[model samples]
Target: MSTAASTEACSTSRRMSIGMLYVDLGIVTRPQLFEALVECARTRCTLPAALASLGYL
Candidate 1:
C-alpha cells in the first residue's frame, strides 16, 4: 500500500482504539462512540473533537 494509505489506516485504527478505551472505562456507551465516529467521518475532524461535538467529551 502507499504510504498515505498506510498512515490513514494507522490513524483510523488509533482513533477507534481511543474510542473503545473510553467505552471500556464506562466513560461513554458504545452507541455514543458510534455516533461520534459517524460525526468524525462526516466532519473530517479528530475523534476527540467529534466526541466533544456530541457532548460525549
Candidate 2:
C-alpha cells in the first residue's frame, strides 16, 4: 500500500471506469469524444493542427 502503488491503482481504476462509460452508459459517443479532443488540439496547436482540422485529431 505504498503511495506510488496507490496512485497507479487509482489511475487504472479511472481508466476502466471511463471505458465502461463509453461502452455501457453512452455518456459520450466515440465520435464526440474524438471531436472534442480534436478541438482541444486545435485550440492548443502550433506545430501541427492538421489532424484536428482534417477530422483525424
Candidate 3:
C-alpha cells in the first residue's frame, strides 16, 4: 500500500483502539473525547499564543 493509505489505516486502527479503551473506562461519547483531544492538541502547536488570545487555550 501507499504511504498515505498506510497512514490512514493506522489512524483508523488507533481511533478504534482508543474508542474501545474509552468505552472500557466508561467514557460516554466519542465527540466529547475527540473534542478534548483537539483542544489539547491546539495548545502544543506553533503560534499557539494567538489561539490562546482567541480563547482556544
lDDT (Cα atoms) of all candidates against the true structure: 0.90, 0.50, 0.51
In Å, residue 50's CA in model 3 sits off its true spot by: 22
Worst 10 residues of 3 by lDDT: 44-53
What ordering of candidates by lDDT runs from best to worst? 1, 3, 2
Best lDDT among the predictions, by candidate number:
1
Question: Which candidate number maximizes TM-score?
Answer: 1
lDDT of 3 at 38: 57
RMSD of 3: 7.4
In Å, residue 29's CA in model 2 sits off its true spot by 12
lDDT tens per residue, model 2, 1-57: 999889756754654455446546655556655554445444643212423354533
Model 3 stretches with alpha carbons more than 4 Å out: 29-57
The pairs that clash in candidate 3 are none
